[model samples]
Target chain A: MLGLAAVPLIADVIDEPFYTVMFSRMLILSIGAISLNLILGFGGMVSFGHAVYMGIGSYVVGIGTFHAIEDGISWMGNGLIHLTIAVVFSALTALFIGSISLRTRGVYFIMITLAFAQMFYFIAVGNDNYGGDDGLSLYTRSKFYNILDLSNDNSLYYLNFTLLIVFLYFSHRLINSRFGILIRGAKSNEKRMENIGFPVYRYRLVAFVIAGVICGIAGVLSANQTDFVSPAVMHWTRSGDLIIMVVLGGMGTLFGPVIGAVAFLFLEEFLSGITEFWQIIFGPMLVLIAIFGNGGIDGILVRLDKWWQIKK
Target chain B: MNWILLLEQIMNGLQLGVLLFLLAAGLTLIFGIMDLINLAHGSLYMLGAYLAATFTNWTESFFVGLLLTLPACMVLGMLLEIIAIRNIYTRSHLDQVLATFGLILFFNEFVRLLWGPIGLDIQLPEILNGSVELIFGIRYPAFRLAIIAAGIIVAILLYLLVSHTKLGMLIRAGASNRQMISALGVNINLLYTIVFGLGAALAGLAGLMAAPIMTVEIGMGEEILILTLVVIVIGGVGSIRGAFLAALLVGFIDTVGRSFLPDILGFFVTNDVADTAAPAISSMLTYVLMALILAIRPQGLFPPKGV
Candidate 1:
């Protein structure tokens, strides 16, 4: 934590603003990945529609900014309003989707979640007022004039970093709580949990909404970071990227998603630098990873720690 | 709307339905017999279109190009199975989905590298180039009619092949009991490859047929692949009969909805908003239907008998 706190300072002395921006994006994605871990890793609910929350979050902020500028809705100018509405709207959307999708199990659940995300993607594309397929661009980032200046790169980076820690700590506390335990319990054996008289559906639904709300926050930060929001964010492929991060970092681990985001985004940066057609390489690499990459980087680190402790 | 236009739109819907059936049949068969979820089945459809375009351009004949594409696509599908898909059969569904997603990326990029990012438009044969009179002073595209005719012919042939042939019996047996068929000394692996190849060929046929009507372009397979997934899901995962019925049903609802949804919504909303929202809501109708059906019957409309 201390070392991370010095990243902006070190990058500044080195005159590398790219590190600040890149790391901030990674931190935001980590929050998204972490929330995904909440349901996907613990609840065993493989939601292929997770990105919709983020997209929703982005659109709320982006569209709010658009209205704030064009229609002179000054109240919409505040980041706090964006956060409030984004969280609420995403929670309701998650509740609605999770309710219907949770009725089906296994493959059906995956498909339905994906279906809803695609449905939303098309909806986002259809709305022309918010830039639709081309995406919305913000001339100014989220404003909190007295408390925080989002225009400052370092402050924004620190803000994202702080939120990441806050969310991480919150997730860790939640996971060890009775509620999170029940969610995990349902995942391991839904039948067993139901036999014990737990309302498994309601528990999972709550977890799904929590994950959505958190991922939506990430989207707010993401829109602020990029100053752009588009329907592409709601695409199933973005959801796939989040899934890859969760799986790569090691499912069911708090810090795993952060690491997954780092590894994934960096690898993407490196590979895309090599060729515009980096997907050709990335495509087969994912196949190989799915085939051979068993325990993710976090899992490997955990295994190594156990081995070292045994040696000691 | 004019009666002629409405009838034409209905015909268009049937054309689309049969095209969907051509793809969905193969997807369902692969799932039924192999119990494999191959996302790259759409890639086969894409390859079919590209090959059809290339071969037609080469031989100066559409039929010949399409003929050549079927075998080419079958070969590609089989090879892909042997290399990539065969490894994931015993793996988890997540792994299969991810690995095939990778395949989609690779195939899309590979096609881009080979064919370039620009879309290829296939030329129609002289016989199928112009409109044909269907009734008194009403006409429709001959090629679209051909697609419908061809789709029906393939559907009937598929029925005979599945219901009557020795291979069909084995496929059914395999779908019902993989262990029993394996114990009976059937080459299950070979069966899997053949079924996958057959599925690929069907997808290819649909793509080639569609090429003249639409641009054969990069990532085109993915757009339609989701629809095929919906068709199979609504039809029931392993039922061919279900796939055909569901494909046509989805075809009519989607095409007809897009055509008329705006007008219907225009009565309720302003013209501009209706026009803007119509495409999205129309496309969403199929998924909405899927959700409604799954809510009512989680097992799908016609789940095949057995495990």
Candidate 2:
């Protein structure tokens, strides 16, 4: 609730083109991270290929805009159709990969997902038509009935913000549903869930597909925001970044991924400005967090809340 | 493809598979025995290559440089284990992943700082620089053949050590049940350190050997590390025998697919389409194999007993 009120005030302070752009980027990434948390945090599915959904989303925007520009198609015919295709495709791919990957527990799941993501990355790089290593550019942003002028910074930022809110609400509701309980239970103990007559694999697969679809939506927003898409979006390191965001925010919480994404991007921007070797500091910082800060930023907040209660 | 060319490619694939095995063996063993995920294992490989390159430049002798650098990598591995890894044995995979990933970023940046962003080439020894002619006029690189031979020797030695030696028995036992082994009064800490160091050394050995063939640069380990992880997954975590076979399967599939997929696809489609699609398909081949294997056997081809 505090965050809800602070949003406009924070926006008013950084009410510039650059800050608007950065904020929108953070929102899109937060959406992706939140989607990942649904599967990884709640369902115990450690996917190293989550970035592929983002790539799929971005490519949908890029390809849709590209063909629309060349063919003069209507916004509904081009933009909406392409976006639908992207979400469906990403979900299907996630379903196929997750079905097999979820069969293996623990380290095997992690490695297989990583490899599959890398495979998609290589395929994207190999496709010369899609700009290969250079990436594809949208000549213009998708014409969304001009209801939301993506070309305008403020307008686009709000659109992303609205989308983020919708997705967060959707995710929150999902987690509190009966389906969510099964997923959480499966994560806690797969054997127990199975013994309780829930088909653990089926629930996890559904969660995986849902996560993929959400990430696909984020990817579309990312493509619209940047007006570009590339194989780099699907790289394993990119997946690692998403995982870091989730961990940083405090996995399984409603606001954790958003906080993580905002903090991470801001840190990257601030640190990179200080020195070219920013990663040297950032890397050790992550290690320190892992070693000492087990619960991430949100975890610390919870601890503080408990302490305050004790004091009272 | 000509029979001779096919034979050459197969040999090349075998060589690549062997190198992957050396790296995967260490990774799987550590994961299986210590129950720790070490994402920075690739950094040790990069270090070995960098150290080998530096020492070779210093001594002007590849063999001598390798001899000195191998033990150095082992020590570095042990030291890192003591300092960072030992503390995380009881932590979640997420912590291990993040911490090790941080190490990778640090090491990559550190390497960039030390050696510029450009890749360095490690020259092969003059004695092993040339190619050898086999039957049917086929020729193969001596260095590649040496890598294959070394891989085989290591595999045999590892097999002997794991199956025959007391330490190997302890390692196998520890992998199956760590608490039970500790209850038997074995020094778990020392065992973990040694296992981690051994794993590092094996990864380093792969790096040193591969330095001549592949580019030596920052982030070079990332791609190969993914492949090594695949090998571990397919072979079954903590099983040396599984790592060996899976590594070979991955190496052969990747090499052969890259070489022949385009030509084979051309027969069915237009050359232009085949040319464009082949690379993508070939790159996805190993992953397809991995997915297929997991779908059939979730525990991998030979999951260590009790893992």
**lDDT agreement with native, every candidate:** 0.90, 0.88
Going through the candidates in order, what fraction of the true interface contacts does each contain? 0.67, 0.79
Best by DockQ: 2
Among all candidates shown, the one with the greatest TM-score:
1
TM-score of chain B of 1: 0.97
Alpha carbon lDDT of residue B197, candidate 2?
93
Clashes of each: 0, 0
Q: What 10-residue stretch in candidate 1 chain A is worst by lDDT?
A: A289-298
Give the per-residue lDDT digits (tens) of candidate 1, residues A1-312: 677778899999999989989988999999999999999888889998999999999998898888889988888879999999999999999999988888888777887888889888988987777787899998777778589999898999999999999999999999999999999999899999999999999999999999999999999999999999999988888998998898889889988999999999999899999998988999998898778877678888988999999999
Model 2, B185: alpha-carbon shift in Å? 2.0
Q: Chain A only: list TM-scores of all candidates.
A: 0.97, 0.94
Stretches of candidate 1 off by over 4 Å are: A1-3, A305-312, B269-273
